[model samples]
Target chain A: MSVAEKLIALDPLALRADFPILAERIHSKPLAYLDNAATAQKPQAVIDAVTEYYTHMNANVHRGVHQLSERATAAYEGAREKLARFVNAASPREVVFTRGTTEAINLVAQSFVRPKLKPGDEVLVSTMEHHSNIVPWQLVCEQTGAKLVAAPINERGELLLDEFEKLINERTRFIGIVHVSNALGTVNPVRKIIDMAHARGIAVLVDGAQAVPHARVDVQVLDADFYALSGHKMYAPTGIGALIAKAEHLEAMPPWQGGGEMIRMVRFDRSIWNDIPHKFEAGTPNIAGAAGLGAAIDYLEAVGMDRIAAYEAELLDWATRRLEQVAGLRIVGTARDKAGVISFMLDGVHPHDIGTIVDTHGVAIRTGHHCAMPVMEFFNVPATARASIAFYNTREDIERLAAALEDCRRMLA
Target chain B: MDLKDLYQDLIVDHNRRPRNFRRMPDANRVAEGFNPLCGDKLTLYLKLDGGTISDVSFEGSGCAISVASASLLTERLKGATVEEAEALFADMIPLLTGKLPENAPREHFRKLAALEGVKEYPSRVKCASLSWHTLEAALKNAGQPVTTE
Candidate 1:
């Protein structure tokens, strides 16, 4: 049997009980949530972690001397360690907490890359990047007089590696690429891209927002200079994410934001910055969010990322096959190596109409540019209906989606 | 909300083959409407002759609700006076928003009542009213593009 078949042979539905929201009904029908790329539904373990932190151990971290403060500090720092291990970073000191993937990229753009950029320095990025990766570099380029260059992608939404290498001249100082596209589910060859950039001494940053939830990520193996991921996308709470960078880069980069916790000593004249990760994380961080992320990591490890990856792969294969059976439905992206996302357009139907029709059937899917307008432009489509799968999703969800789509076709006809 | 209510036969037919869905070459007033949320976009054209709408048309792509609303608007405003069009706009807002009283007279919105189903879906209100909003902009001769936020 194939890997997908073997994984599906096992009962994956047993794991669905962990997420309470999945059991809830929508429009009197069982909710078929296919919007995992936008944000995943949090598990009860993560929810309990946040509530437990706020209920029993609630205090500011890093400066408190009381018992509760110590406990909170341990939990927060413990989460940092858990995340560092989750991504296989060299050390927890290399992990810096931020608001989300957007903030993490912005921090790197402003703190690490901005100071070194010159008037004509170029930053290379792919056309498939999410706005979080593109906009931060654009803002930094605007401020620093640097140029932002985009590499081309093929009709299948796969990045053209040869064209990307051709664009890499001496002026290219940084390369920002997404690990997996949220719009097309294309898993770009990030390790190869990073190695190509590193060969020329160009620092590479990988936006792992859509990646960490689907597959295993090893920053050390990939040798990526910087990798950013959002906790919310990985079944954790919102408003928390991490940026994992090399120790040398983190040490060399200046602090982006300044506040209480980031300073060693503050005076009217000058202030000494804190060391490493703490230096980058300014102000009072999201302690409960960190606890929740830690719990999320624990949950993922318990279920095994390898199993989740296999199960989701099976789910994606099932969904792709079922969706292909629908007439007049054209999938936007067909990369050879895709994750769990499938973006498609129905005959003479706008994505919004499709979304509304399916929503009445209790099927949830994302519709629109998906924050990747450049991808939309490249595909020559105004919008597309996307169904992104998670491990908890089943073949029945895909069936529901197909049925709802058929209903939409008949009604719109 | 029932899907049948939202996707009525009239709305779907109008969406498939919208009426007056073309550009007016000698139009004096034109305004474009865009809803960035769902990528619904359209440009409305109006030819006013002595304070009365002589010709009305629109050209763009949008959802079923948006296209149907725009098509219905063109048909309703074909020979309407500027004052009558303005009054229709005032009547349309309450119907889409469910703010009209139970006894409120809707004779002015006769054929346009097909859009009252939008009141059930709060998020879709912007789609049903985008063309109407753009019509208001065209009537004012506002050069700026209208966006339904």
Candidate 2:
């Protein structure tokens, strides 16, 4: 193996040691966590960052002239700058912190698309979006007389780019698409999609919840109008995320939530809104979570996103090859371009049963529709077992997953 | 945490070849059960002869525990009255929830004892009881479809 490759995940102890949960034992066996697509386990840096924030700097942000408040506000706002830099945003003014990807999408749906939509207007999305991406747009479409259109995917779980292009029309007001499908791991050609939408003057919101963790995303390079990301999916604490939008989009969007911190001044009849980012942040935010997210960003940058991607790609290839050799195991998604996720079904065995069986061996994987029911229906199955890999995962973890599946097959199939 | 405890031989056998796995087209009562967590869905049909469950059957897709529990329910509830079926379902809940009295008669759960291991897998307790909940909803004539969200 090359020196760079050896220095990465192949040097498993160095990277794996950073995550405290890697040493955990389940059912008298070493835990093999392959559920990165759902939520990633935090490293010590992230956990310590959260602890540092709460222990030393605990105060409500944007409030008192007190020292703690200033420190807390500095940390909170510093996290926003870090998020902007992570996505290569033009300015920190474009990044708005929210609860997570769900809230981020909902904010765009309510504040951006709802006003622009009219009767007979359409909002476009892919067939493989999480419920969070689909349901929010559906709610906005329902409120207005607008329609929601989903572009289809092929047997390989790849989006039909030509079909997606054909669906865009003059009446298509907005497009919401997932950058990486959590269920299938298909990384959509987001740049091409964004270009197509921009050609017709339609804005697109890229659900980057699954993308930001595994790959480097440059908003400036992709020219994405809006990008929604979840902190928990990227080894940060839960209840914290950011929506990176164009400065023009943020400036034009009406504040969806009106509360304590979102206004410049409140009047009896009307309330004046604050600036670009803070106008959208209404309540006392998850400041500690954001600080932890900043720490996670530091950790990833220290390791380098390019190296992480290369290491995970190798691990994913190893896992796919290992799982394919097992008898009666069928992989569901086989897109030409994919991230570090594999969804498969074993003959005569339900995904839930496989999940339970694997848990006995301390191999943790996700088994379900993965919040993409439409994708499951298209595959003609109820659910599939998903083993999503990360840079910290070793080859032994994949072997344990394969062995556990064979045991499941022996018991049930 | 043993795999055999959850996927016992009887559960595997029934899931492979479920009994009365068909739709009763002319049944008087019917209910659809859905577990949104794992997308296990089942449609239960009943042929009631004046409050007596003259016939019971289920048609749907699910895991071993779900399919086996439904198959066993159909096998045991045949020829039972509505009250008797409800009482048996009531008796099955404790087995799933780990609330069964230690001194309770062991004879009561002859076939259903296979599902007792579900108490160990808390996330899957709904899989073992999806059908029974659907049966309860059907008995009560709940117009809405039952869901273990």
TM-score of each: 0.97, 0.97
Could you give candidate 1's per-residue lDDT for residues A1-413 as a string of tens digits? 43244345676676777799999899999899999999999989999999999999999998879989998999999999999999999999999999899999999999999999999999999999998989999999999999999999999999999999999999998999999999999999999999899999999999999999988899999999999999999999999999999999999998899998999999999999999899988889999999999999998887778989987898798889899999889999999999989999999788999999999899999999999999999998889999999998989999999999998888885
Candidate 2, TM-score vs. the true structure? Answer: 0.97
Chain B, model 1, TM-score against the native?
A: 0.98
Candidate 1 regions exceeding 4 Å error are A1-9
Candidate 1 docks with a DockQ of: 0.78
| Error at A319, model 2, angstroms | 1.0
True contacts kept of 1: 0.74
- lDDT tens string, model 2, A326-390? 89999999998999899999998999999988988999999999999999999999999999988
| Location of the lowest summed lDDT over 10 successive residues in candidate 2 chain A | A1-10
Assign candidate 1 its CAPRI class: medium
Clashing pairs in 2: none
The 10-residue segment of model 1 chain A with minimum total lDDT is A1-10
